[model samples]
Target: MVTPCPSLGPPAPYVRRNVTHPASLSAWARLLGRYARCIRGRRRDENRKRGSGMEIHWSHVEEISEDERHAIEARLSALAAGHTDMIDLRIVGRGTGHHRHGGKEIRVACQVRGREIVAVRSADDLGLALDQAIDAFEREVRKLREIRSTHRDERPQNPPYLGIVDRVLHAAGYGFIVTDGGEKVYFHRNAVHGGLEFERLTEGDRVALNIEAGEKGLQATTVVPAPPGVPAP
Candidate 1:
C-alpha cells in the first residue's frame, strides 16, 4: 500500500455568511431610483428649452433672467403658432449708445416661404421694445396673409364686367352670376358693393362686378347693381 501524503496544516473550519446587507441593498435600490428620476427631470428641462423654433441674439446687452427669457419665448411661440409657412424666426436685442439715454432696440425677423418680414422697435426698456416689435411683426404677418388669400398679385385691374344674376342661394349666403361673355362667376354675400344687401338680389338682375381667378374658380368681387339706363351686353 502506498503511504498517504501528510497534511500541510490542520483543516480550516467552514463559515456561512449573508451575501448582502439588508440596509445596503435597500440603499442601493433607492440610489438607482433617484438617479433615474434625475435623468428624467433633466430631459424634461431640455425639451422645454427646445420647444420653440425661434432664435434670440443679444448684442451689447446684459444677461437676462430665466423668467424674462421664458416670457419672451412664450410670446414668440404664440405668434408663430397659426402660421405654418413660417420657416424661421429670429429676434435681435441691441443696447444703444447708453442704457439711460439711448435705450434698447429689438428687431424681429420672420422668414416665410421665400420671403422675409421684419419689425423693429426702440424703447427705454428691452421688454417694451420686444413687445412693440412683436406687435408690428404680427401686423405684417396678418397683412401678408390677407394679400395671399386674395391673390391680389395675380388679379387684373381691368374695368368691371357686366353680368346678370343667374342663381341665388339664400340660405348659403352666396350666389352666381353669368357674365355677358357667358362665363359664370361666384359671389359671396360679403362681396355685395355699397353695403347692398345680398337678399335684394334676384335672378335676371343686372350686376357689375370685377372678376378674379379665385381658389375655386372665377369669382366676382365688389359686385354692385348695374347703373340704370346701361344696356346689357
Candidate 2:
C-alpha cells in the first residue's frame, strides 16, 4: 500500500499562535503604556504624601483679589523663613458687617513641633486687615525664635546646681538629689561622673549636679560628689 509522506496533517489548521498574531505589537504597547501610567501614578501619590515642607491654607478669603492673596502669601513666607521649625500656616478673614460694610477681621495660625502660634487683626479694608495680621504673626514668630535661642544659650552658661543626694537606688542604678532650693532632681547612673562612683553614693552624700529639663521634669545632666568642705546648697 502507498502512504502519504505525512510531512504535516493538512497544514496544522492555522491554530493562531502568539508569534503569528497581528495584534501582538499593539497589545505589548498597551501593556507598556499601562505600566508607565502606573509608575507615574505611584510617583504622584508619593509626592502628595510627602507634601511641600511648609504649607498655607486659606479660609473666607475668596472675596479678596488675587494680588492680595499673593501679597499675603509672600509676607507669611518671609515670616516663616526665619523660623525653620515652623510649618503649616492657616489664614482666615471674615467680614464683620453685613454686605461687607463694617470691616474685615483676619486670623493667622502656625504650627511648631510641640505647639501652635496664632495672631489676629482687624481693619476697615481687606488689604489692611491682611497686612496687620501678617505683621503681628511675624512678630510672634520672631519672639518665639528669640525666646528659644535664649533658652538654649542660657543652659551652658548657668552654673551647676548644688545639692545633697537625698535618695539612692543601687539596684535600679538611679538616685535623687535635693537642690539648695529644696527641689528634688532625678539622676540616672549614666549622669554620674563615673558609673562605679554611683555605687558608693549614700542617702546623705553631697553632690553637685547640672540641672536640665527632662520629659518627666527636672533632672541632672551631670552628677558628681561635691568637693570636700563644700556645703550643700
Candidate 3:
C-alpha cells in the first residue's frame, strides 16, 4: 500500500502559523502624545511658579491687578521658553479666590520649571489633575506633622501597659505578666521599680509595667506588684 508523502500540506495554512499578532503602534503613539502634553503642561506650570514666586502679586488678596496680570504673562512666557517638554513637577499653592459671581472656588497652582517655575493656574481650571496633586501634597504634609509630633525611636517602641503576674518563683526572681491583651510579658526580679523582692508571686497577681524593648523582643520594666484585691494599673 502507498501512503501520501505528507509533505504537501497547503502553503497558505502553514504560512499563517507565523502571522504577526495585532498591535497598535498608532494608538501607542497617540497615548504617549497625550502623556507628553500633560508632562509639558506640568513643566510650563513649574516655570511660571518659579517666576511668580520671585515677584510679588498684588498686595490685596481680593483680586489680581494689572501688575499681577503682566507678571503672570511674563512668567508663562518664561515657562514656554524653558520647559517645552517636562513631566510631573512640584506646585506650591499661592493664592485662592472665587470665579466671578462666586461660581467656583479657585486655588493658585505654582510649579517650578528650569531655573525657576513659571506655571500658574487656578485650581478650578486645573481639573482632576490639580485636585489629585493638592490631595497628595496635603497627605505628605499630614504625615510630616505626625512624624514631628510622635517620638521617633531608633529602637522599637511599644505601648506601656498594666499586667498581672500569672506565676513567679521567689527564688528564681523572675515572673511573667499576664497582659490586658492576654499576652505574657516576661520580667526579671530586677524589673521591679520598688527594689523589693517578691516573696512569692502567683496567678491572678496584679501589676503595673512599663513596656520595654528587650534583646528577644518586647518585655516589661518598672514592674509594680499589686495586692490581691486591686486591679493591675
lDDT for position 162 in model 3: 64
Task: Compute the lDDT of residue 137 as modeled in candidate 2.
Answer: 80
Runs with alpha carbons beyond 4 Å of true place in candidate 2: 1-52, 98-102, 155-233
lDDT of 2 by residue, 92-185 (tens): 9897774444378888887543346788877788778788888888887778777877887657543467888889999766788899899999
Ten-residue stretch with the least lDDT total in model 3: 108-117
Candidate 1 lDDT at 215 equals: 48
Model 1: residues with Cα > 4 Å off, grouped in runs: 1-63, 98-101, 152-233
Question: TM-score for each prediction?
Answer: 0.39, 0.42, 0.28
How does residue 94 of candidate 1 score in lDDT? 85
Each candidate: RMSD: 16.5, 15.7, 21.8
lDDT at residue 152 of model 1 (Cα atoms): 60
Q: Work out how many backbone clashes candidate 2 has.
A: 1
The TM-score that candidate 2 achieves is: 0.42
Record all residue pairs in model 2 with backbone atoms less than 3 Å apart, i.e. clashing. 180-233
What digit string (tens of lDDT, one per residue) describes model 1 on residues 142-196? 8887888789668655336988999999877679999999999987665676556
**Which lDDT values do the candidates have, in the order given?**
0.71, 0.70, 0.49
